[model samples]
Target: MDERLETLAQRTGQWLRTHGWRLATAESCTGGWIAETVTAIAGSSDWFDCGWVTYSNAAKARQLDVPATLIDAQGAVSEAVVAAMVRGALARSDAQVALAVSGIAGPTGGSPGKPVGTVCFAWGGPGAAVRTQTCRFAGDREQVRRQSVIHALEGLLQADTTAKSVP
Candidate 1:
């Protein structure tokens, strides 16, 4: 619960409202922290439509329409999965903008290729090009999750900035 994070979320809300767009999130490792941050802002209901905590592959498939085959092929934390998650979030809600996050934020779950603190993010919107990013954070479980939430909010801001600058 960093105040700067709250400020970032507020800034994201301002931009979303200015653009007259709503947002939805499909979260995994950070649980619903991204959703919790946005909803903490007063009047966020105007811009934040909903959030799905698709922690399991089954839930991702069932709730967000993320294909099981994709997860099996790319793994849940991969960019492809996050991309599909963003699509699913956009499709499931009335939100015009969507963000998705999946990560291995743990003291465990570390592979040589995809270690703990490896978080993947994707952001997309109607007629807007999707953006994806991968980051390796250094921290414990709580710290990694906190960083993931911050990064997700930052992604929303960054995505909007990139989209607006395109034309």
Candidate 2:
């Protein structure tokens, strides 16, 4: 793992612990990289709850309760699906906070609207409204995945600063 990612994970763990919260992750495209990065930190079990890698559309639908109709309408990488994914993560875990990521991080799989490196992210919990974003990063597969993980972590940190507490 990158040192910066490790640092971000460390910070995220601290934030979650401070609020007596735990985190769950729903991942796609980047596989389980987000989960892996956070769990790499020692004692992450204190703040990390669980993670699901729903790479295929079917898996997303079945595991995360992301509707098949929604995926057909908006695509798995769309903001809507990621929002659903985050909701599902929160529903399935005891964690008070959850994050979801779905993207086309590739040397291929680029469409006119959603090119490669196009990723959607969502964060939500019991009391917080789900926050969603679509980002277009420029990089190869590994780089795009790395950026996605960084952005996911940054979003958590941002919530810590901007809100009274993270969801």
Candidate 3:
């Protein structure tokens, strides 16, 4: 594991534990990398709830309840799909927080509009409004996935901070 990624995961686990919150993940391009990184931390089971590797559109729709029509209309890598994924993950799991990721991380999946390294992320919870983003990372497949994992972890931490300040 990359040292930076490991550090982010550790920070995320610490934050969730401090807030007595559990986290769930819904992954697409990053596969289960985000889940794997967080679970690598000791005692992560206290803060991590579950992870769904929805690599295929069918899996996203079936496991996370991401609407197939939404995926077909907006594409699987869109922010809308990731937002739905996070919502579905939280709905399906006993988690207080959740993050979702979808991307075109590849040397071959690039198109003119949605080129490779295009990743979308979402972070949400029961009371917090769902936040979504689309990022264009510059790297090969492995690097893009690595960046996505790191970004997802960071987003979780940021969302926690935002939720804390909402009062």
Candidate 4:
């Protein structure tokens, strides 16, 4: 993991511990990198729940409860799937805060509309205060995944202020 990523994860862990909150992650294109970065911190188990690496479409549907219809309509990398992933992660875990990411970080997955490096993110918790966004990053597969991990941690740090539904 990158040093900056480690630092961000440390800060996020501290935030979770300070607020008595635990976090769960639902990941796709970045695999388990987001979970790996957070668990790298010592004592992360205090604020970190298990992570789900739902890389396959079936996994997203079966593991995250992302509707197969949604995946069929918008594919896996859309805002809808990512939002469902967040809800599923929070619902399935003891976590009060959660993040979800799905994207095309590839050398070959690019299309005219949804090109490579296009990542969708969702952050939320118990209620209806979810925030979702799509980011088009610049880089190769490794770099894009790295950026997604960094950005996900950055978002987690702000959950206290940004998520009205999270406690």
Q: How many residue pairs clash in each candidate?
A: 0, 0, 0, 0
State the lDDT of candidate 4 residue by residue for 13-120, as single tens digits: 888888899999999999999999999898999999889999999999899898999999998998888888998998899999989999999987989999999998
2 versus 3: better lDDT goes to: 2
The sequence of per-residue lDDT tens digits that candidate 2 reaches over residues 63-103 is 98999999999999998899899888988999999999999
Q: What is the C-alpha RMSD of each candidate to the true structure, in Å?
A: 3.1, 3.1, 3.3, 2.9
Name the regions of candidate 2 deviating beyond 4 angstroms. Answer: 160-167
Could you estimate the TM-score for every candidate? 0.93, 0.94, 0.93, 0.92
lDDT of 3 by residue, 1-167 (tens): 77998899899989998899999999999989999999999999999999999999999999999899999999999988999998899999999999999999999888999999999988887676788888999989999999899888888776434221211
Cα shift from native, residue 115, model 3 (Å): 0.6
List clashing residue pairs in candidate 3.
Answer: none
lDDT for model 3, please: 0.89
Whole-model lDDT for model 4 versus the true structure? 0.87
- Across 1-167, the per-residue lDDT of candidate 1 in tens digits comes to 57987898899899999999999999999999999999999999999999999999999999999899999998999888898899889888999999999999989998999999999988887787678888899989999999999888888776434322111
* lDDT value, residue 58 of candidate 2: 99
User: Candidate 1, after superposition: displacement of residue 66 in Å?
Assistant: 0.7
Off by over 4 Å in 1: 159-167
Candidate number that wins on TM-score, 3 or 4: 3
- lDDT accuracy of residue 137 in candidate 1: 96
Which of the numbered candidates is closest to the native, going by highest lDDT? 2
Locate the minimum summed-lDDT window of 10 residues in model 4: 158-167
